[model samples]
Target: MGKDQDLLHAVKTEDLLTAQRLLQRPRPGKTKLLGTAKRVNVNFQDTDGLSPLHHAALSGNKELISLLLEAQATVDIKDQNGDSSTAL
Candidate 1:
């Protein structure tokens, strides 16, 4: 699978290290690590329309939730069932 797919898998499996590494890559023409192109889109949804944030929150993984938030995951995104991370 590609890096983006790998990133989604990492988040689903709660693999914090991999997820963090992906998010930490430096963005082009930027010194900050927050906007890396190498990083997967935090807002990417699965077939069920659930974002990584939804998975993290649904699993009750507070640390993962925090990590995703730090990585700029959108908490307001809704799943297929209309459940946001906050609602999960």
Candidate 2:
């Protein structure tokens, strides 16, 4: 497994706090961090193209979700498979 892949997994595991701290640290290149408490799409699921909001929802992270929404994450953004919005 690669480093980015591991980060994605951590995001999916609802480890937003860990992810946030990691994202705060500098990376070598482009991998810009969103700084939002969203989950990572490690597998890149089509239907679950879930951003941090999706992760927060599944984990009941209302606070994180609010923060991501404030950061302007599309509330209606669908996954790769067009599974409607993460709000669903």
User: Top model by lDDT, which number?
Assistant: 1
Q: How accurate is candidate 1 locally (lDDT)?
A: 0.79
Backbone clash pairs for candidate 2 read 38-52, 39-52, 46-81
* Per-residue lDDT over 25-80 for candidate 2, one digit per residue giving the tens place of the 0 to 100 score: 35456565575335443223323476555555667767566555554555665666
lDDT of 2 at 20: 60
- The sequence of per-residue lDDT tens digits that candidate 1 reaches over residues 15-63 is 9888888777465687655543455787888889988788888778788
Q: Which residue pairs in model 1 clash with each other?
A: none
Name the candidate that leads on TM-score.
Answer: 1
Candidate 1 regions with alpha-carbon error over 4 angstroms: 27-38
Segments of candidate 2 deviating more than 4 angstroms: 1-8, 22-48
Candidates in order, TM-scores: namely 0.80, 0.47
